[model samples]
Target: MDYLQSLRMFVKVAELGSFTGAADQLRVSSAVATRSVASLEERLDARLLQRTTRSVTLTEAGRLFLDRVRTIVDDIDDVEGGLLAATGVPSGTLRIAVQGSIGARYLAKLLSAYTERYPLVVPQVIFSDGPISLVEGRFDAALTNDTYPHPGSVVARAFAHLEMMLVASPRFVPGIHGSAPLTDVDPLVLLSHDDGTAGVEPDPVRRWLDTNAAHATHIRANNSDMLRGMAIEGMGVALVPAVLVEDDLDDGSLVQVMPETPLPSMGLSVTYGSRRNLAPNVRALVDLLIEQSKSDQLPVALRHEDAALVAGD
Candidate 1:
């Protein structure tokens, strides 16, 4: 049997869940497609599919084999695409993940621009408030904050730094002013991503909680947008990316809590598998992001680091 061709036929059959459908797509006869998959299973000595008159399904072994086979196929395609880089246009589904509201606020625009440039590449976006795994085969690339753990098998390139600041509505905590010292403004309610259990390395907010917000009520939510909304409604004080609340600050809806103290800026990185050569779609997306990340019009983009960015730990 032509092993690679069999694998391709099986992959298409598994994806479409119909032998006739797979055969039509592969431009082969249904008998040829069925024979290829049967030959594959015979060689492997494992039943890869459960065939019924109505539909087809993958067995347990088939499911596991499918994942690895997909990788092998994709890697082959990536190498071929790279070889034809000069002539071929990048095409395929590009799956990307972003950390949270901050990513949605800023990185979404960059992705929108990327789609415009690479129309052939379909983009799938995942927005998460917690850790994202690149090796798990879920995401092709991700936008992650430096605070979160990055897998060693991936390469992380920090491009932008978000200057975080403590903020709240003036009506929430009336007496706090810009000139007031950090010691004087004791927050009644602390709105944060961590409920003091996350054990994230000490940042400005964590240090502040050590003194001022020590005895305060902890209002924890995984979503930064939710925390920002809470702060806007005068529910509590929150540490947020300054860029996200610019309009609120200007409109007197939200005020900066601590003006004198410097808050640690969170670094943003693009994480991908540590391949020798990136997939065509992945490389295009990353290069476009690096280009789009350095505009003087946006304060966060202006704060972007040089090309010599910090990599994964």
Candidate 2:
């Protein structure tokens, strides 16, 4: 058995705390990963992990071994990465965590473009709306909304500036064309991930609700496409990414409401931990994102009717 390969697998299992998760990340089967770790343990004469149906954790000896092995593994990777960086041919599987499905459509396009440019690179994206630690989740990098609070440990760079706007069907909010106070809008659709009721940067919908002095929302969803769809169906007024509803506005199916009150543009960032040496594959991705972010063009526009498709994603 390759000792270095076993060490690499052990490190992943420790980081993710799941044999299955580590195996999936390494692109190997559970049995292969389990056997690799077991082989490592046998060589060391130390049990490195305590595995149960509920969780996988490091034993006392495992913890000590992990601390040393993690550093050794990182050093080896850095040496190999230095060569790859010099060659500029990023060849590896990049594990990425996406904040939510809100940007799924555009993210897919962006990754597609990235892969095309660097055929040697493979990106494995994990879609999650809730917060997941970059370290605990064992991610190479993360694409996140700007509002997501990061510890001082990570490096977050500009990814894209997504213009946001409030839109409604003329049938639902008759006062959309007129200068009516926000109170006239009966229902307000909200994006759940952006909720910051008590925090510094509140969700756009939360800001609107506070402005109108309302207590509740008509609809609250994590996906922007879903909110856009609600607005199109005349459910209520929704603040959504301009790119998602570009065609709707063009066709007049959805008209911009409250044009005077602008919604905050959702800023996206590519974040990675600062402690680790930037991997060549991760660096390549960040470089591409920065290049594309020059003109708010991270993703292509999608029709509002495609909301269901994006929601299911």
Candidate 3:
């Protein structure tokens, strides 16, 4: 018995829940597919599957074996594709998910340049503000503000850091003394992701306000754009990421309320599930993202040492 072929058959059977379905996918007869899996079980002296008239289910051993088999198969495919991609051409779909705010400001330009360089590569981008689980999602990779906890099964690279700032429209600025500290502002207008959490908690701006402002009120907007628009109309002071409001700051539409105390920068990272090898397409996308990260145009936070050096200089 071909061990690898048998393993593939087993996985297909487990996934499809029937010998006929597996056989159809593998383009072989149901009998052959069934025999291969049966032979595999006999060779190992273990039954990997439980067969009923209507459905097939994995036994305990089969469940454990399936996870390992999937990893191995994925690695083999990655290795094969990596070898093929060495010829200087990468062809495949690269699916990526990113935070809504980040993607809104940067994805269009990045995709344009990436596609121009590798026309054979197709790109799909999903935007979300919530944490995306790699195991459950079909995404080849993701760009996010937070790092993953389990690095063993995933590869992660820090790409950028973002500085958030407190700002208000010209009209709102007059409500408080021009030189007052950020906390003195009343009626804060906040923008946040609509992920069910109250905008007042887990937010640095909210924390700062709670600590410093004796009298603070909040108006929560579900989307960042809505938040910005409300703030622009002189609703109240807003704590927003600097990059998102750069243009407004430049045009004097928005004024920085507290420029002295910079909000701590958050790191942006690119991550993918770590396989021993990867498909040509996935590898290509990873490489491109890494290269793009090295460029000055990408948003990143300064390293502590780098910040120290700048301060000293």
Scored by lDDT, the top model is: 1
Residue 181 displacement in candidate 2 (angstroms): 5.3
Whole-model lDDT per candidate: 0.73, 0.70, 0.65
Give the TM-scores of the predictions, in the order they appear: 0.65, 0.61, 0.61
lDDT of 2 by residue, 1-313 (tens): 8999899889888877889877875678999999999999999998999989999999999999988987787778656755666667688899999876556667787888899988998899998767657778888888776557653245567556567677888787673444454555444443333432255567544565566536436566776777878788887777677777878989988988777764556666678763234677887887677666654454454222110100000
What is candidate 3's lDDT per residue for 1-313, written digit by digit as tens? Answer: 7787788789777766779866765668988998899899999899899999878999999999898887676557557656766765666788887755653575576778778978898998887656566656778877765432321244565655667677789988776666555555455544433433343234444445456653556665545666677778888776666777878888998888756644555556667654334556666766665566556666432321121000000
Q: Model 1, 173: alpha-carbon shift in Å?
A: 4.4
TM-score of 3: 0.61
RMSD from true fold, candidate 3: 8.6
Query: How high is the lDDT of residue 260 in model 1?
Result: 78
Model 1, 98-149: lDDT tens digits are 7766556676667678789888999898887667776564688988775566
Error of 1 at 239 (Å): 0.9
For candidate 2, the per-residue lDDT at 109 reads 78
User: Which parts of model 1 have CA positions greater than 4 angstroms off?
Assistant: 1-88, 195-216, 297-302, 309-313
Point out where model 3 deviates above 4 Å. 1-85, 129-131, 147-153, 190-215, 299-313
Local error of candidate 3 at residue 187 (angstroms): 5.1
RMSD per model, one decimal: 9.6, 9.4, 8.6
